[model samples]
Target chain A: MSRGTLALCAAGLLAAILYPLVVRGLAGAGVGVSANYLINVGMLVFFVAFIGQSWNIAGGFAGQTSFGHVVFFGTGAYCSTILHVTHGWNPWLAWPVATAAGALVGWAIGALAFRAGLKGSYFALITLAFAEVFRILANSVEFTRGGLGMLIKADQRPENFQFRDPMWIYYLALALCVVSLAIAWQLTRGRFGARLVAIRENEDAARALGIDVYTEKVKVLALSGAMCAAGGTFYAQKYLYIDPSIAFGVDKSVEMLLVSMVGGAGTVFGPLVGSLVLTAINEGTRSLASVVPALKNVQPLSLIVYGAMLILIVARLPDGLMGLFGRRKSGKRHDA
Target chain B: MLEVRGLSKAFGGLKAVDDATLDVRQGEIVALIGPNGAGKTTLFAAIAGFHTPDAGRVTLEGHDITGLAPHRICAAGMVRTFQITQPFAKIDVRENVMVGAWLRTGERAEAMRRAEAVARQVGMGDQLDQLGADLTVAGRKRLELARALATGPKLLLLDEVMAGLNPTEIAEIVDVIRAIRDSGVTILLIEHVMQAVTSLAEQVYVLNQGRMISHGTPAEIAADPAVVEAYLGHGAAARLARGAAHA
Candidate 1:
């Protein structure tokens, strides 16, 4: 790592650590519910970034683009929720179990799809199908209370994995983001990551070079799934509610993918930056809709803007938003 | 160090490789030479574990490796390069080689050092910083060789590695490959370049219409009627023989 990147990372970390405190200070200065809203927005950025990193791991780094990552997310959310609300297991205990369940789903899907010689679009569609299957199952299942959804008991105690203050949740999201960033960082530096990049570039070539493409694909998917599932659990805890639509929705899948691809897919900070930009756009449009009398209740404006931005990102900024910043030197070729 | 016996693989109704038998003894360079559609590559794939042979067996260092995955076959001490170059376009040449080097060592620095050495060995040291996609055709071919070599394979399979190379480049690669064999790696190459085959390979196997036609020293294969008929049309060998007799 270069000194510049190291210093930049340190600055970013410091800013992230101080974000909540600054918001709290602003609130102390007599800001209204908007201040608390800003805090929530910050939390959303990190939370989305965390799950986005999960998508980035398999889709971006390994070139196994999945359209149904929500399968894992839903699996995580349902697993923990079922355990906590129905089985009477604590959320803290259920978190790890949910994460493992997510990973198992990832492994099963990857193994089946890859072993069947699926790649690119076929692989993607299969993942989407899996998510849909899970969604239908969740809706029809009795333990999940079907379409009624499962709601965790509202107990505002840290011991119960519920907190009275939203700020504590924001801090938790920050920690998850930091950990995810560290994983992405390790990918750029570690042997496993190099193998993934190899597979992404060309799978047959990677296999010819002694990489087990099936094994690596499965491994990365599980890792990504585990991370996403953990995010689902945190999301459930934050809302104290998880329904089929919320847990296994295509919206979360798209959000995760958009944040990663729009920011930068393979890079560590891409999803984080994407989350920030997207959440800002979402909230900014919401506030705009509030102020504008004619456009009141028109939440779809953000979707229109979002659609336009996605097109632009796909067409002009093929490398994602991070390309505007700078390329990682290690990823660049040195000329003879 | 590698032996293949009665290896056969078919794609749909087409028999890509039919009862092909070849071997590479310890520290020897063997060439599999045939005309296009002769199934030389299919045979290579079967031996290297990309295509599971419908029949027969592949053994490396006295251990049966038939039906193993490519990586497992590589771990068992054999690796193959692609006919069309497959380079990791996003990564630099050194990093490309390191993906293969990581097979030998898990340590990044060690893999880096080892990858550099392999690159230099294949005369790609100066281009180590260049991305895989940026390389010229000859460079890509060499990169393929470098990557396979980095795995420290006991037996190396070269699938048409000199297909697009000029004579000068081919000669240079020939020397590099010769040095590799001298350094104790066995080689099984598929080549149409007769100059390279005659110069580098000690044993030559000829394939025609998905079957192994003949195996011998390059000179012997050249003189054989079956080998000549395979390369030319039917009875071209007889005409050549008659022409030679008339001469």
Candidate 2:
């Protein structure tokens, strides 16, 4: 391992150990739900970061740029919900199955599209279509509560993977966030990563160099999907609610892409930074709305802000905010 | 040792490489020479497992690897470089070599160590920290060679490695190729630089209109009428006739 890798591992370990205690300290300081809500927002931020990191395998690293990651998220959410609500199964047991479902979906899509020679904008469009179709199907399905969505038990119980204290959920999400980051880091470091970068930079040349572009791409896609699916299961567990709009929304897909791209798509920490900043901004805007009645109906502001930020990021710092920091250089030519 | 047998590739109706057959012995340096549309690159692509041959087979050390994916082919011990140098632009030269070295070593330190060795071997040790895009054209070509060499390939297929090099750079590349061959690696080079091909290749295959027009020793092929015609066109054939008449 390089010094960089060791330092990252140490930093992650420190964060994992200290985060829960920090949240507890804030609660004791009489911050009330304000601090609790910040922790809540942190949970979402971390979780989004995890999902964004996973998606980067295919989207950023492999240059597949999927807009249908919600397929995995929704599947994982539904599978975990089914296991918990109907069969009374352990959350641990359901988690792997949800991840498997996601991987399989990703594999199927990858094989069909990649084998058929889809890439660039066409691949993006195809993935976007898959997400839309999944959303519509989930909405019309009765077993999924149709448009009504699935609702979990409100009574807090540890045995059921639910707790009275939101802090418990925060710790779980934090732990998961760390694990996801580790996977992302390991995947992008080795020979496998180099091959993906080569494929992304120039597919034909990669092929000429004896790279199995199709298999490499599909594997990354499946891995990314599995990770995102894991995030979905956790998200469902935290909120105790699942709906077509929330679980399979295109907006959520866009959110994942934006978060990763804005932070620095291929870098290990990019998505986490993006999630933190965006979620904080989101929370601040919501609070500002509460303070001023005039801001209540300003629905278009989020889109406008995100759109402007995206344009600025692309035009100025194509690599993202991390590129601005100078701590990391841009990805290699193949990484592009 | 590499053997390509009856290799055929068709893009739509056109057969880019029709019934091409060749063998490269271990530690031998062979050249595939042709004009712009001779399908030398396409044949290289097929032999390296980039393109699925319409028909025929490629055997590396007697393993039938006709339609296997490119990376698998590489793992099986053959590595190829592109015609136009494709460097990992934004990353430093050492990192670009590291990507190739990573194929063999799982650890970063080990790969970087090997990358430095390969960089030195290719005469690029000093430029290890330079980004790929910042390197000159000749520098990019050297980076490509270093990367390919780092993969631990037993057989290397170099496509136009000396395409745009200055005379000094070309000589340096020739030295590197010779060094690689001396290390028990077999080489099959494609080149339009006929002088390099004639000087370095023990055996050469000439391609014309996607067909092998001639295959022989450099001296023998240089004297062949068909070879001269393929290179300089029918006008050259007429010119040769006029020179012979004047003599």
Candidate 3:
């Protein structure tokens, strides 16, 4: 490992060792379990980061920006929710099914869109339109509970992956978050990573160097889609609810992009920092609104905050915050 | 050896390349020269498999490569470089070259080693860690050559590499191409600078109005009426030759 990689691993180990104690200590005090709740929120934030990181494989790394990733998330959620509610299936069983479904959808998209020569901004638009169409379809479909939405009954079952305690959900999400980071690290280090970077830089040049651009691109897209779909399964089991607006919404995709952009799109550790920072701000806004009744009337402040953060990060620090600390001459300094 | 037969391409009603045929022997340096818009670039593209010809057959040695993808063609022991450099601007120079080296070995460490060696060969070793976007035009051109070389190509198609270089840089690149040819790589160069062509091309092919106007030694092509009329216009070849002689 390089010195940089060693330092990052050490820092991550330190954080992992300290985070649980911090949560337990806060729970000991009269902080009303806010720390625990925030930790739970952190899991969601990290989940968003994972989506962002996965999205980068196709969007940032392959130079194909996709705004329809939430479709996979929705599909996973619906698949798991229906299996558990209607057929009494275990969440574990639903996980692989959801992943396969996601991969299939991704392959279909790649075959159609790439073969037709859709790329760049045009690809982004097509993905966005696809997500919107899925959202509309989910809202109209009766099996998805339509506008009534799907809600789980209040229960505690370890096998079902449902509990009254949010801590269990937190641990599960934390595990997924770590796995996502590991996958992202592997991707950016391996030969496949180099191919993606080459294609992103120049497709024609990559093709002339014997890199199969279409096959590599589709493979990355499938990986990204599967990751997002798995996240959807986690989301459904944790919250015990699925709604068209929450599950298939375009805003979810935007949130993923925001976290990735804020962290550093092509960099390995960018999404982690972005998730931590954004989640803290998000939780802080909710707590402040509870304390200050005047802020209760402000419904969309979190979104406004997200938008402003994206703009500020893009304008002042185009390379993201970590880039400011890295050595500039190395050109490994995150500029994008 | 490389062979092309009945190569024809058209844009709407106008033919860009009309039933062109050519062959390049092993270790030979072939120059393709033509007036502007005579379809030299187009023909190169077709040969490289970027464009599917209206009707043609291309073969490397005895292996047919008709309608194959560009990457597939590259894997068959050929690579190409563009007139406009297409370096991976966001990455280091070595990493840009590594993209090509990955074609052969597909092992990161070995590819990187080869990339560095090729960078040094192309006179870019000191700038290995430099961002490709930050390089000067000449540096970018060298990076392009380095990348093409890193692919372990047996046949290299170079398009307008000398277009914007000064006289000194042009001479340096000419020397590099000669070295590459000496290293057992057959080269097909599309060049406008006659001086480099005259110095390096083992055989010259001149195209005009999408047809081969002449094909011979540098001295013979200089005397061909159609090649001269296509380039220097009527009665100008003699004066250009005198100018060359004086210089």
Query: For residues A63-122, what per-residue lDDT tens digits would candidate 3 score against the true structure?
Result: 778888898888788887888787777777988888878777777787778878888888
Q: Model 1, A1-336: lDDT tens per residue?
A: 677777888998899778878878877888765556777899999999999999999999998999999999989999999999998998999999999999999999999999998999999999999988888888998998888999999999998899888788988999999999999988977789999999999988898888988899999999999999999999999999999999998989999999999999998899999999999999888889888988886766789889999999999998899989755565332221
Q: Which of 2 and 3 is the better model by DockQ?
A: 3
Best-performing candidate as measured by lDDT? 1
Q: If scored against the real structure, what TM-score would every candidate get?
A: 0.96, 0.91, 0.94
TM-score of chain B of each: 0.98, 0.96, 0.93
Write the residue-wise lDDT of candidate 1 on B1-247 in tens digits: 7878888999999999998888789989999999999998888888888889999988888899999999999887899999999999978899899999999888887888899999999999899878788999999999999999999998899999999899999999999999999999999999989999999999999999899999999999999999888888889999997998999
Q: Assess each prediction's global lDDT (C-alpha) against the native.
A: 0.91, 0.83, 0.82
- For candidate 1, the chain B TM-score comes to 0.98
Q: lDDT, candidate 3, residue A63?
A: 72
Best by TM-score: 1
Deviation in angstroms for A91 in model 2? 3.0
Candidate 2 residue pairs in backbone clash: A210-B70, A210-B71, A211-B71, A333-B88, A333-B89
Q: After superposition, how far is residue A321 of candidate 3 from its true place, in Å?
A: 3.0
Clashing pairs in 3: none
- Sort the candidates on lDDT, descending order: 1, 2, 3
